[model samples]
Target: MKNYDVVIVGACTAGTYFAHLLAKEGLKVLVIDKDSEQNLCKRLDIFHFTRDSYDQFDIPVSGDGDAEWVHDFDLCLSKSALDNHPKKSHTKVAVMHLPLFIKRLRERAISAGVEFHFEESFVDVVYNDQKQVCGITTTKGYYDARLVVDASGIPSVVRRKIEDDYIESFEITPRDKFYVLLKYVQLNNPDDKVELSTSWPYYKGWIAPQHNKSGAIIGVGANISYDYAYKCMDKFEKAIKLPEYTLQYEEKGCTPYCRPPLSFVTDGFMVIGDAACLTKPWNGEGIPSAWVQCTPAAKVVAKALSDGKIATKEDLWDINVLYQRGEGAEYAGTRAMLIGAVNMSAKDNDYLFANDIVFCDDDKGPNPNVVGTLLKGVFSGKFSLGGLISLMSASNKGEKLKKHYQKYPESPAGYHKWAKTALKLWKKVGTMADTVKDA
Candidate 1:
């Protein structure tokens, strides 16, 4: 058996980045993927990465001449259902080819001393006498490792195979996922070329610049399935005016939209990236968010594995604390609030946009009299009473969940009690899937 310090399944963005970080910590890391190197990350040809994230994560920036680089845009605009009340936000973003970007990440990981084995699919996890995960069985053969990390995206191959009390093996159901469909289209009018990303939150749709100067990508994500997403796109196009374009091609993908497992670690095992549902509640972007967990996790895992000490749940508990108290808490509240916020009528949505409420881009911050404004809207008949009540209830529940997460347990001894309360709170907070309207 080939022995390694850590065996990571899935060699995409999350796996390669984590492997590079861990290998830099002087651990022997090995990454395996079911797809060949040429085929990895080919599902999506083009994707966006915030320019500042490269510096924040210490990642190499792809320049204009680089194979991965397409172009950069500085503004993202969000509009109401009626196409009024456009909210503009500024952040430079790099457009890149996904497969080439993954190739770049892989090269970095290799330079950091991580081994890569393409075309090796995970079969199952190998457990020790104590029932702790010790290695993994792949289609090719068995490999022994002290730590096993699952960055296996949505399928969560390795994580789903683990039957442990600490780990939740629940499958990410259709309702718990965002099915995204992207249409690559060429603008009919040369003057109407897409230059920046623009989104309509009501439709969960956006049109962004593509690699070709005259081409753009129109995308929509919805619960249930790709068919539902297409239905949403049809509604969006009818409700708002868009530049005429000729369709070139289409691509589809899915991202986990549900809350992540409360615990991301167990004895000699950890799960990160999409496998752990580490995505932004607002946008369904997983790369930077997953790295947020990976930064602290690498430190904790490195320390636990130092001096050849066997890593246990007790030793890995800090990873949960660090994340749950920080980004996890923030996302919990935002996710909860969004469920109710998006459930309003199109007229009420336009009213909120006009009043600079939830969809506002005010640089000053949230309006202090938000409740008063909602009450005013209710009195003016601009908003429904039931909608107001639902929004308030969801906001209150979100705040409570955030507070509870901030008090995350510091050790395994206090975990079960904390988790029990968290589950109850999340049940009340609800999910984005709850906002899906009947087709």
Candidate 2:
């Protein structure tokens, strides 16, 4: 039986990057994935690593100017470019070919002496008499490790086996899942802006160009089922210009939207990436977020190992604390603000776009005082009173949650009490259909 200092159960970007970081510290790391080496991360859609993130992750860039700035829009062709645009610093992101990008990270990890275990399905956690995770059992066999990192995505085979009390949410409802489809299509003009049509509050279609101007990944995201997503994507294709030169590829996947756990660390274990639900709730963008979320985790883990201390729950708790105070909190607040907006009818949404009330054409996404703008419109008889009330209520609810997240505890002793407060506030958030009356 071989034992490693750390075992990572996913080969995606976050998992591979963490392995590289850990191995660089001279830790004996093992990375396992159910996917075969040749078929790993077979995603055809484009992924992004936003600006200021490249240096943070230390990822090598193509330098072909392939890493270009991208923009989002409500309706580009209609000339109503209302949007939730990235800040100026984040405006230009590294538009990546995810398969190649992941390959580079994997090879880097391998060079740093991280071992690979491919085509092995994780069965369950191997626990010691102390009721702590001691190792992981996989299809091939059982291997002991001082720490196990579960990045196996939302299904989270290893995480699911853990006792319920350890996690924030046991499962994500179907309504909380986002179904996505991306098809690579040729573009007549390569200089086109990345288009996002938020015609549906919870569902949006996007057009992202390949940096080489050769083609683009056109995609649609919805909380609906896979069948409905495919149907929506099909209808969405007709709106875009069809392939003029070549249609390169197409892909589809689904991800759940659980609130990020209050804590990702437990006795001898930590979870990252989709398994930990590190995705941004707004756009369902997990790639860059996963990178950011796991980077803090790696630092905390390294600190424990460097001090010659075991990676116990207490030692690893900072991973959760730091993230909860940062991006995790941001995502929580954003989700809170979106519930009411998502339920609005298409016509009412169009009114916001037409008036430049919500998606500001200016550099900022929405106006800083968006609710104020809505009220002024109400006075002018441009917007309805009911709409004004909904936005105000949603905004207030979101603020309450953000403050609660900012109050996340510093230690386990205060965690459940804080989490109980969080869960209570969370329940105050109603479903889109339930919260918003039909217009």
Give the TM-score (vs. native) of candidate 2: 0.85
Candidate 2 lDDT for residue 311: 75
Off by over 4 Å in 1: none
Model 2 worst lDDT run, 10 consecutive residues: 72-81
lDDT of each: 0.90, 0.70
lDDT for each residue of candidate 2 in 1-439, tens digit (9 for 90 to 100): 6888899898986689889989987888999999998888875436655655677777765545343233322222222113322222124455666777788788888999999998998888888877778888899998888889988887777777787465653665556677787777676665543443222232366665554455667677766477777776675555444345456676788776657777788877888888887887656778778878777777788877675434778888888788888787777877777775655544455556655554444454556667677777778876677766766777788888888888778888898898888888888875432442321
Q: Write the per-residue lDDT of candidate 1 for residues 1-439, one digit (tens) a residue.
A: 8999899999998999999999999999999999998899898889999999999899998987899999999999889878898887888999999899989999989999999999999998999999888999999999998899999999998888889878899899999999999999999998997999999888888999999999999989999988898998899889988899999999999999999999999998999999999999888988888999998899899998996855889989999999999999999988998888888888878877877777777464466787999899999998888878978888898899999999999998898899999999998877878887675
Q: What's the TM-score of each model vs. the native?
A: 0.98, 0.85
Question: In model 2, where do residues sit more than 4 Å from their true spots?
Answer: 65-90, 187-203, 211-214, 234-249, 306-310, 351-358, 361-368, 431-439
TM-score of 1: 0.98
- Highest TM-score model number: 1
